[model samples]
Target: MSNTKNTAHGQVQETSSKSSSGTRKPIVLMSMGAQERAGHEYQVMTKKYMRPLVEHAGCVPVLAPTCFGSNDLALYLSMVDGVYLTGAGSNIDPSLYGQENLTPEKTQDQDRDRFDLPLIHAALAMGLPLFGICRGMQELNVALGGDMYQKLYAIPGMREHREDYSASVAQQYADVHTVKMVPDTWFASLMQQAEIPVNSLHGQGIKTLGKGLQALAHAEDGLIEAVHLPECEQFTLGVQWHPEWQAAQNPFSIRMFQAFGDACRQTVEKKSRN
Candidate 1:
């Protein structure tokens, strides 16, 4: 599935094969971030987020740039079986959630915020499997009418969740905290565990959950760590952690991505019939 060629318009054209079970690899549309470097702005997505989908999830990753906005969204959604909203260094614009921007030093990706919020609702409307990580999870929440703490550490009773940028990559990604799974929820059932340790690397956290979004897990400080939409008939889950970082080696990360891949394949099968 590694073979790919760019179309005249620069879109990735992947060549994939069907498994022995006669099922083709599921296609997942992942959102990208806008970054300014040197002199020009670029749409970017790190390979860290893409590798988990390919290696563990057994899916083809398609990158969606934020610059396109809503114009071609339906076209992109039409071809993919699942949507993956990945984490980014930028925070969502605080204005979207009725809050003023407090962290001037921390960057905000409004283009991505504009693009992903609508993408979240539309993907769920189509019954596509959707998985969000870190900022992506916060987007899912805000899209569904929830808000976030502009600065989580400033909030009373909440622990500092941001990683040390000065540390080594391995040190920054090391498991630093625990999240207790809500019993009988989709996450608990899939993980088959009461609690799991996770790496934290975000400054903002969910303050109020979106409508129909169930809290799947929580941190020791009572922060929401994972979420799912129970009413949605598809696999819709979001986690406020860097699950994509070394996802292949972690037991919990492996199970999470595999479950998303299965859901995406199920979606493909359903689409073929309809």
Candidate 2:
């Protein structure tokens, strides 16, 4: 553990450990929300799948609320070394990307968009490490001036975006599927194995990429599965698969989080000097 502080910019500041023998644990913020449930219940929750992922990656997971006011948003962003945009149950409004609403199965979570979009901009501005999963990945694209397909099934001849497989078995996990990783990519090094079998569970896919973003990995069906910002020195990787769910049983997925944690630690160390 290391001492954590807040900078003038309202970003969380951390000091790396003096000991050089071990890797420092990164303090990560996982985004969450509160919504009106059936009846009189107001449900506020964070996904159970994200916990082991962070822990295994050698980082501390902090639940960040999506309803933060502008001031609180800065405070929240300032308190973590890195941010993980977890998957949500809703689709992002297309209006954010300067597009007409095309899908009927839209459940817009404006609060999340409000919280995450600004935080993302701040993080990128501050050079903080970021990782997006599924909806998180989609949101990252939108935040970066990209557009999404809304519904993959509606793409005429597109195959299923959501893969069907039992999550319990690692051998069966990459089951009969392959994703091509771009040569000489950071993601290729992090994932170690090229042509990885990834589990997908989203109706949406990136149609137009944001500026300065490069597709790191893609499905055999030509769907974008992973992306990275090559311009940013810090780690800003987004994957369509649920690495959190697979981290426990899959070494391939676990390394992704570990790599992110490593990046956050490095960022904290570099910032400590300035």
| TM-score for each predicted model, relative to the true structure | 0.93, 0.83
lDDT score of residue 166 within candidate 1: 100
Pairs that collide, model 1:
none
Candidate 1 residue lDDT tens string, 33-134: 989999999999999999999988889999988886777899999989999999999998888889888999988888898899999988999999999999
- Clash counts for all predictions: 0, 2
Which digits, one per residue and each the tens of the lDDT, describe model 2 over residues 177-247?
A: 56899878877887787788766667789999988889999988788889989898789999887777646
Q: Deviation in angstroms for 168 in model 2?
A: 11
- In model 1, how large is the Cα lDDT of residue 193? 90
Q: List the residue pairs that clash in candidate 2.
A: 11-78, 12-78
Which portions of model 1 show Cα errors greater than 4 Å? 1-15
Candidate 2 runs further than 4 Å off:
1-24, 40-45, 163-176
